[model samples]
Target: MIRVFGMHNIQPLLNKVYPKATTANGVYIYDEYGKAYLDGSSGAVTCSLGHSHPRLIPYIKQQLDKLQFVYRSQFGSEEAEQLATRLFEHSPERIYAHSFFVNSGTEAIETAMKTAVQYWQEKGFPSKQQFITRWKSYHGITVGALSLSGHPLRRQRFESTLEKYPRLKADLENDTLEKLTEEFVQVIESIGANHIAAFVAEPIVGAAGTALTPQAGYYQEMKKVCEHYQILFITDEVMTGLGRTGTWFGIEHWNTTADIVAIGKSLGAGYAPIAATLMTDEILEPIKNGSGLIMSGHTYSGHPLSCATANRVLEIIEEEQLLDNVNTQGEYIKQQLNVLKENYPVIQHVRGKGLMLGVEFDPARKGFQQKLIERCFQNGLLVYPSVGGPEGKDENGILVSPPFIISRSEADELLAKLDQSLNEINQ
Candidate 1:
């Protein structure tokens, strides 16, 4: 008998042998040996519906049998049209009037970047091409997205090839809204707003900032500045979109809207690979009147199967009223985390909205984040690593964003496992 070895994948760790997941159901992933691992971070905060969801399987199978692949320019699919309509209906009113589907978060961001540039071009300002971004953000992995992002580590290797976009080192958490808005005006003036196309930022900073959330009036003030300069405002909601933050859109928490929005992660709910670039009618109107086309898409931009899978995912979220569960269980988890923070000096801060929570460790105790992650893994729990500290480069944080469908009992179990992991690391 001949044994065949499958091709090896280039994972984050090359020298380590990670456990092999054979099956997964709900919030737990089972290894080949039948050991179950709780999905604490929802697979990098993407799996909002958990694993092997029974409801999703039949829907996917049905869609697979009906229609799957289709070229974007060749034809149109109701799956894509309906998904776009659903996203607009759920978004903040007067916010999203159209959606451009893509294969990944990075593609959605790249598409958004192009759309913003084109929006300015159609308005007869071709010099409006530069973008302004904060230092504590991770937009995407593509070249164009990477150029706009301020994530130091992710941009290190590609620095030479990336564009020299201005990265404002403004403190969203500590600075007053007035100071923040002033800083924005200063940068816009310095760069000459006519040369800038958009100001891009994450609604709540995700992996790069450890779910760092700004003050109540932050977005409102910032949006005002962008409008004053005639610059577009784009929010990267890849991690917080589709009810992850207890709202249809994370920016809705502040009652602010962006000119362009990028949504992914939970849109497919771990069942498919999909993302989208959403824009307001004001954004599309100028381009539609001038160029008659926005000029962004991929061969599989609107893959029918992926669209169907994502559409059903949204339907289930609406059907089950999962946003309510996210709020209820998120508060319970947040309250429990605060108690843990009181007991443990290592847990310096806890912040974020709904289920998209983050725990920042004391910077003085370096590498404590990885220690806790390994401990959590040993205890059959999982968590996503994040960066924190003044510069936002230190990996001293962890995000605890789990699936939205998590129940109170499951929340207790997750908290217990996390508590145990923290205790072990403290020892």
Candidate 2:
């Protein structure tokens, strides 16, 4: 007999009917009962290469044979160094130089925040300790990250414990680049720009539903403010980085540069735990000239096995032209979702870029999101629920971010499953 704790259930003793995952292969996870679940969510948008990848296994084994772990403070690994070089090759020119590897997205977020603060301190602005983040955005789950996040349900219980930060609420309904820019500037002014260290956001908001994209020129306008105020701009790409968004990074869509980018989820492609904070020379040079050391360090920072796995993951993505696949398949998926939205009144909207798409249910439809989630599971597709909304409230929606390698047939199957599930829920 085996037991496990539920992710958010109140009863620890309650029996959760989680299927025992025995194996996974090519966009599907199979249980001990041999029931296959289409990995429509890519295991929370983490598995970029599907599962049981033929090439990844060999690379992982080779790295494991050579080295599995190394404390960053005392040792260095070729895998980590090589991965950093590869990241720069894919990065925007002169925008980012240093990479700080960590174990998860939350750690990456923490590191980015700390790095932002350190940058300001080293530049003779130690009082620039405050942060500004957007509402309806998620950075991570740690207290610091949560403080920067506006996801309602995730932060309600720990509201008192989280750090206080100015939250900008963008009105999607009446948004104009000029108005949004003014709003951003007002928030900074109210917070006292001199006291702020950074402005952080997900280039494409995840976890809060709608993948909540901003208006055109929105990020550029915000970046302008950050640049003028000497505040570091941070883009949290934990879910939309790599090839998931049809580009190397979500920020690329806007052609905007970030001072710090906290990336993870697909960094190790669900094979191993790894995340990293990529910082610009502007953020690092000041620190380099001052203390000559980064204050943050983790035991598993740049773990050799994880870095080796990520390097191979990047290699596979580049070699296989997965970015092109994400572009083509993502457009087809969006077209299908738009058709579904047109056919069903329950689907209020469809949003997001590339594979990181979302379908929001009518808020007026009671229990619709939950019913759809359960129905999708019964139909053998697993999608993520967009649980919380702005200001710690529950929102009704589903996020669909399958692996970048999902084929046309797999994409069709995913759409079919969703359509069937939605039809059942409607009936």
Candidate 3:
């Protein structure tokens, strides 16, 4: 029998019931009792290629046969180099020239933060150490990334730790586009723009029910603000990259490029733990001209096996033309969600781009979220709830990000399950 070796009372993602062990192929997961469930949310928006893709295992095995680890500081491997080249090729041309690999999204953010600070110091602006980020955004769970994040629930326990740092002004929902731009400009000015190192944000906000997309021309305006202040614009694309948003990167949808881009989740297609921070030549020039050494690195920074897995994942995406599938399937999902909104008065909002959609429930309907989850689970579907919002507020929403390989029939199946769940919950 499988046994969990932790406190029995510690809660899991779902509080009402303990999860059962299971196994399955592709996008399906099985419970201990042999019940199959479709992974509609792609396991918190990872698994873009789906669970246990046959190609990934062979590639990983091939790499493991050669080498597993290569110290980033002293040693390098061909797999890492090839993966970096692939990432650069896939990104906007002339934007990302170099990559720094890490084990997770949080680590990538931490690396990006340090790189920004060092870039300023090397460029003779030593006082430019402050970072700006938006509210309801998630960078990662590590200290540096957490410090840059504005998720209230995640920051609740560590408030004091962040209070001591240079605080970035948080954006509120009620703020109009003009108000936001004005406030952002004023904050940079007040802080002495030259003293700020970087302004970090997710192009399309995730975690907080996929929040609001920037207003039309908002990002262009923000880029101007950053350029005016000589501050680096770092886009956290951990959740929105690799065709998840019907583009190579979500920020690309806005036609804007960031100085530094942190990618994870779909980077390795959930087959392995690997992340990368890609930066422009301008950003790297300072470091190259100065110390010529990246001050941050981990032992497994360029693990060959993970790199191999990621490389294969990218190959599969391109070979199969998954981006086209994402665009087509994403449109269908959006259309279905809109229909759901029309049918269910309880669905307060249906928002998001591509496969990364969110369905926010109205609080007036008590027990809506729990009932929704239960009904969905019973009907062989799974989704994740929003990370923050008022308790019992039904700020609870479903994240619908199925694998890129999902077929039209599978999409219909998901919609049927979702409709059945919503209808049952309404009763």
Per-candidate Cα RMSD to the true structure, in Å, reads 1.6, 2.4, 2.9
Model 3 lDDT vs. the true structure?
0.82
What are the per-residue Cα lDDT tens digits for candidate 1 across 1-427?
6654532676777777777899998999999899988898999899999998888899899999999998988889999999999998998975698999998999989989999999999989999999999989999998899998878889999899999998888798998888888888999899899999999999999999888999998999888888889999999999989998999899998899999999999998888999999999999999989989879888889999999999999999999899999999899899999999998999989999899999999999988999999999989999999998999888899999989988888889999999999998898
> What TM-score, computed on C-alpha atoms, does each candidate reach?
0.98, 0.96, 0.92
Model 2 regions more than 4 Å off = 1-15, 387-392
Tens-place lDDT per residue, model 2, 194-232, is 899999988887896468787778788889989898888
* CA lDDT of every candidate: 0.91, 0.87, 0.82
- Whose lDDT is greatest here? 1
TM-score winner among the candidates?
A: 1
Higher-ranked by lDDT: 1 or 3? 1
Residue 316 lDDT in candidate 3: 91
In model 3, what lDDT does residue 219 have? 77
Better of 1 and 2 by TM-score: 1
